[model samples]
Target: MAVEHNEAVVLRAIKDLVIEPIPVPDLKDNEVLLQMGSVGICGSDIMYWQRGGNSRFRLEAPMIIGHEGSGTVVKVGSKVKTLKIGDRVAIEPGTPCRRCHQCKQGAYNLCPDITFCATPPDHGNICRYYKHAEDFCFKLPDHVTLDEGALMEPLSVAIYACRRGEVTLGSKLLICGAGPVGMLYMMAGKVAGASQVLITDIDDNRLEMAKSCGANHTINVNGRDKLEVASEIEALMGGQPEVTIECSSVDYSYDLAINATRQGGCLVAVGRPSGRTLLPLDVALRKQVDIKGIFRYVNCYPAALEMLSTGKINVKSLITHHFTFNETLRAFETAISRDAKAVKVIIHCDQ
Candidate 1:
């Protein structure tokens, strides 16, 4: 007999959450239903909670909203052979149509027709049971925890950022903002053999946390002018860096990144600013610097999971805080608290 599935849901319309019985959507021939256990409260999720809506991606209609998540497979479609019931896995939010040119070329991350788990009206992974295409989910090794499986989502972002930055052995790297993304980028840099990685943040506690997560040096940008902060970073790292990855959403951090990078080096902005700012094009052009941009991530999850299972990357240090599903509101409040000491705040659904 098929086990009945009912789950709690976080609905944005009620400005609150609700736990109710829901019909388990029938799995398609190529799909599977996963029982989610852990989910990371993403910056985007906080944006929704804090502002009630993240721009046009509002909850005008009730929508389930979690993307950084992991779960155990409960049922598989008839065509699913690689996965089985009870297999722990990292759920890839976006399932691109394999017939697309991008998917055929192994660049499926660029597919425009991807049905991502949580984007606006589309329901996300926050629900207890989620139905996703079988091929999109990656099974985790027994040694890796479900929390790490959830982290694979962000770790993939770090992977994509490093690949885009062309990070390599002996490369000098600068990462701005000691948030989860920045820390993951630090770990990714080390995996890619970066000779040294320097991280900067306005918060000393965050910088301290960054150091624990493999940063070679930390810089506090608070109370210091941009030029002074840039100079301080240069001093710490021995010179302007060959690459600067901006993970903070502040516009000025972009300028700081440009100023802190060596001539002809590259600058990658991983953080999304609140609004547009003036670009330092003259500076970039004069110095022959390459300014690049990253949008979410692409084609990096498998590599991220393999790295985690092989012990090449350990991201659990970033999990400084945890919350139960019922504490989602408090979790959001804590994430914004000035005194909150957290690199990653994970929510446990199974508990």
Candidate 2:
């Protein structure tokens, strides 16, 4: 039978969100129903909220705007033997076409036909209840909170980024940006066994937050150019870092990342740049630097949940503010403002 539920709806830009009743689809043979618990407001959510567009996707029509969410499995289908009702799970937002070559190679994040949540015409999981494929609903262990479950989405991306960057034990890391993703990358670095981590940001408050998250040193790039910031980071580390993670979409951040790494070090491009700009490809080529770009994340939810469940990384400090489902609009407003006062804004969907 079809089920009914209420979901927070973003019907237009710079407007209030509404909770309205909607029909939930009947569970398919490989699907499960989830009662959403907590969701983290992401940068993309803020962009869509303020200007009503993000890159290729735009608010051509009204859409729900959340993808980093966690919930409890309220119902399960016949084929779902790995999960059961009442199990807390992190729902993977993108459903890639499994038949694609990218999916076959275990890099489904690049699948062209993938339909991701929070994108235009793709209703997100800001609803009180949601139905998703059982295969994508990863069961969370008892020790992991729903908040941590929600964070698994971004953490997955970080994991993929770090792996692509080849970060490992004893790796000296420098991160550019102190937002949610950058902070999580610090935690990921720890779990990956990095002896020390360093981060820099324009916001002093965010740089302080990065210290709490395990940054061994912090650099203020407020008035410094890319090269100047790199010199500061190098002096702080006593040498260029082995791995540099670029978490800010700003061009200078990218430049700093490229210039801050050691001669043979790796640079991971994790953030999406806002505008087309020239980069120092010539310098990188001369130094033989390895550069890797991330699309989203592939097969990382389970490990991210475990990172919290096993206490390998702390995430409680990440959620500094909270909002009820009805206050999602306000949540986005605070997020877009780059309020260092608000580290990670969490929205309680079922409240």
* TM-score computed on alpha carbons, candidate 2: 0.95
- Best candidate according to TM-score: 2
lDDT of 1: 0.82
Please provide TM-scores, in order, for all candidate models, with all chains considered together.
Answer: 0.94, 0.95
lDDT of 2 at 4: 58
lDDT of 1 by residue, 206-299 (tens): 8888887778999888767887888888888788888889988787788888887889888887877766677677888888889888766777
The list of candidate 2 runs beyond 4 A from truth reads 1-3, 14-16, 337-340
Q: How many residue pairs clash in each candidate?
A: 0, 0
In order, the Cα lDDT scores of the candidates are 0.82, 0.83
Model 1 RMSD, rounded to 1 decimal:
1.9
